[model samples]
Target: MTTPRTRMPAAARRTSILVAAAEVFGQRGYAAATTDAIAQLAGISQAYVIRSFGSKEALFIATAEHVLDLVTDAFRTAIAEADDTRRIEPLLGAAYVRLAADRGALVTLLHLFTLGQDPRIGPIARAGFLRILAILREEAGLSMERATAFLGNGMLVSTILGLQLPAESEDPATAELLEATFRENTPLVRELFGGRDLDG
Candidate 1:
């Protein structure tokens, strides 16, 4: 009988592949990203990538999952640091703006929301959004239905706005406009998230 070759740890392999796939998908979009490019970016053979992920769709799902995880982590951090419900929106909005500045992440996020809506990602996406909603509600002491509507709308609006903008618009005026927009919208988010009014 022939001896089998030693396999790399699954966690390490998957992490490396996902990282590479993220870069490729971020740059090229899901439709344009190739396994060959992902493998090359990962410093591994294409066969390895294929063997590990099985298909382009699977790899894209993994990349999307990674991005969602990052978003969840960011929100958790934002909520934790906030002094009150009113601070939640501004902190999260600030995080979103910072994420938008990341070219790779912004591109990847736009692609995911635009075209990567296959059934494969449906459950994962739902779970992630639900988790976020739960957190927002718990932190703000909102009822279930209200939390769902508020967080869901906030995410959709944020994604749409992020997608409509270019990845690297270098005009200072545009930068100022975006900053102003975020500031103006922060209060709206506070209201949606159940922040108490000062005048109440």
Candidate 2:
């Protein structure tokens, strides 16, 4: 006997598609990634994926925004859960490290950064970067210098994680870079690498 198909709520189904799209777009750049792959991964029909998001471009944009939301949401959470006596920088850095453990989302955001030259995605990418900067500046009360420093470190984390460099910890250069870059979050990043899901 065949098992019955599960029915998900519309919101849940949309999120599911976006999740699959992120994985596809993250692994394959937007120009190369297709809705069919996303549909197959999502266990939905390509027509349904189009019906849900209108088109591939729209779906890519949605997925990009979704991952940006994940990053910003983590920052907001760090801000909210910050210890009164402890510095917010380390807390925020740890939060970024934990969230960056999701290789798909991190790579997707990096892909989005590259698409900043595309007419369709450029403005959105710039706006997303500024949005994160604003949050660090206005909400987190970080000065421009501190925010820049954090962003620089975030880029390093993204690059290291994207390249799976931690797996090369035995190498002197990679080990030194990861050690200096992650510092206290080194163990956390190494442990969670390819181990955690963003949606979790």
Candidate 3:
């Protein structure tokens, strides 16, 4: 007997659409991502995506903001759960390494950064970037230099992730960069790559 697929709840379905949109936009960039592909990936109708998000521009904005929310939320969780004795930086790094498994979100941030000249997206992107920086300073209680270094390290991780080099530990340079970039989070990176390790 063929099994029936259960319908996704409204919130879940919307989250799925946003996720699919992020992946499509990350892969194709904002200009080329289409509602049809996003719908297909989301297992929903294109009409639903449009009805929900209004337009491609609106969808892009929502997706970009959603990605920002995920990053900030992860950071908040790390801060909350961090041990008072140890530095929160490593916990935050581990949290980020865990989140970095979402290549779509990682790459979407990069694509978002390139739209600095865009009238609509430019402000959103800049604001989101600063928002993270601000959180590191005001909420996370990191000094100016530590916060800057944390964000810089995150960008480096993003760059390595966007390059897709961490998929395997085959290339010497790729392995070396992965080791260097992910240093303390090497085990998490290995887990993300499915048992692949720095040994090779």
Candidate 4:
């Protein structure tokens, strides 16, 4: 029932809105970002933004959720399809490394944590993480607690990597060095999973 003309405009507007939100959310963070500013960046009025998205928080939530969805899909697909279980850590590492290249996701995450302890965002982010952990746990046959813990640690390391490195720092030697460090630490992951051969 929708014509291309109508659909095209809607799609364009949505992209414009998201792009504006990413810029504001990246620079000032979620809590500090304002709808007025986002609208200004988008070259639209605040009312127009509110009509499209309910509020600044809603916009941030959409942006964060969008990035998380991509991460979840790419991560699960890459790890699940790989022939070797030993590649899980490195695969996950590579996923985050790729995500870090997306300036929007990195900035969104940095701003998300900066927001004061709110029960709303916490559950959403937590649920997304738990879902990923559940996938890893179910696939890897790891216990719930162990899976969550191990994935938590992995995410922490990935966050640190995202924060410390620039997006353009695409050095094969650096990646190899990190991968080697990950390989060397297989014993630690094994210990975390109740001494299982996760690296196998």
Candidate 5:
């Protein structure tokens, strides 16, 4: 026997759809993902999914915005919690590492970034990216160089996750490179990626 699934409020249902959309879009990319897949993941009808977001492109834009909000909130919280101004970069980096465990939003945002040539999505992606950079510079009070370095390291982390490099434990060179690359954040990386192989 199984319990019946309770109905969600409209707002909650919308959010649920977005969460499912993020996971689907993250795995399949915007071009490949379909509302039917998202609806299946969300345990809803395709009609409801379409009604919630209008279209796949609109849903993707919403998903991108949602991901940006998550990232910006994480940075804001990290900045607020930092006791030492000098430690802000590491704090923010740690925040991102923690978030990367979820993988959906982060990977989806990465997919969004590759659409830089799209007249519609390109501006949204570029603006969202620049917004994060702005937060690091203005809100986090990091200098331009430091902010660039932080973002560069973040991009590297994204790549590592995207490539499933951390799961290549048998490759000593990969292990060594990751160890050196993450340095102080190596433990977090291990925790996030340890013993996990990429999905087929």
Candidate 6:
């Protein structure tokens, strides 16, 4: 006999669907991912997923918002615990790298960023990107140059993971660049990427 499924509370179920949506959307991106796939991943019916999120676009927006929340919260916590203002960038960088361990969310955020041309998602994506920059500049108290550099480095990390370049590339130049880029967070990067051959 099959065991009966335990009913999850509405909030928990919604969260689960979002998590599953992130994973699916991260892999396939916004246009390609479907409610059916999200529902399958979340172990719910497609109709239920629609009822919960109202639509795929709504779900994508929620997922994108969730991604921003994760990034902002990580930076906020790092900033709060930091003693030296100069160390803000490094602390925030480390915190972001740590969050990358949740690969789905990281990739989902990146994917959402690329949807800036979409009428519905574009505004959300632009606003989210600006919010992160604002936190680095305003909240973290980093200068414009510092904030730009920090964001550049973070984007580099995202590109490295997105292309799986750290694990797949065999070029010495690529490896060297990655090494220099992630020199400060090498261990955390390695740990997050699961001992991948980042050495090329």
Which candidate has the highest lDDT of all?
5
What pairs collide in candidate 2?
A: none
Scored against the true structure, residue 59 in model 1 reaches a CA lDDT of 85
lDDT of 1 at 181: 54
Which 10 residues in a row give candidate 4 its minimum summed lDDT? 191-200
lDDT of 6 by residue, 3-40 (tens): 99888899999889989998898878888999999999
lDDT of 3: 0.83
- Candidate 1 lDDT for residue 177: 44
* Lowest lDDT block of 10, candidate 5: 191-200
TM per prediction? 0.68, 0.91, 0.87, 0.66, 0.93, 0.89
Better of 4 and 5 by lDDT: 5
- Kindly list the per-residue Cα lDDT of model 4 for residues 33-111, writing each as its tens digit: 8999989998888998899889777888777777677677777876776678766656665565556445566677655
lDDT of 4: 0.64
**Would you list the rank order by TM-score, best first?**
5, 2, 6, 3, 1, 4
After superposition on all CA atoms, what RMSD does each candidate show versus the true structure? 9.7, 3.2, 3.6, 9.4, 2.4, 3.1
Candidate 5 residue-wise lDDT, 35-78, digit = tens? 99999999999998888789999999998888889999999999
Candidate 2's C-alpha lDDT? Answer: 0.85
Over the stretch 16-112, how does candidate 3's per-residue lDDT look in tens digits?
Answer: 9999998888778888889999999998899999999999989998998999999899999988887772558888888887776776787778888
Q: How many backbone clashes does candidate 1 have?
A: 0
Per model, state how many residue pairs clash.
Answer: 0, 0, 0, 0, 0, 0
Best by TM-score: 5
Residues 1-200 of candidate 1: C-alpha lDDT, one tens digit per residue: 99997877879888888878877887787878999999998888999888987999888877877877777788778878888876766677666655544445555665666653667766665666667677767765567776665566555546535444322224566445444555655334333322222112
Q: How close to the true structure is residue 117 of candidate 6, measured as C-alpha lDDT? A: 91
What is the TM-score (0 to 1) of candidate 2? 0.91
Worst 10 residues of 6 by lDDT: 191-200
- In model 4, the Cα lDDT at residue 37 comes to 91
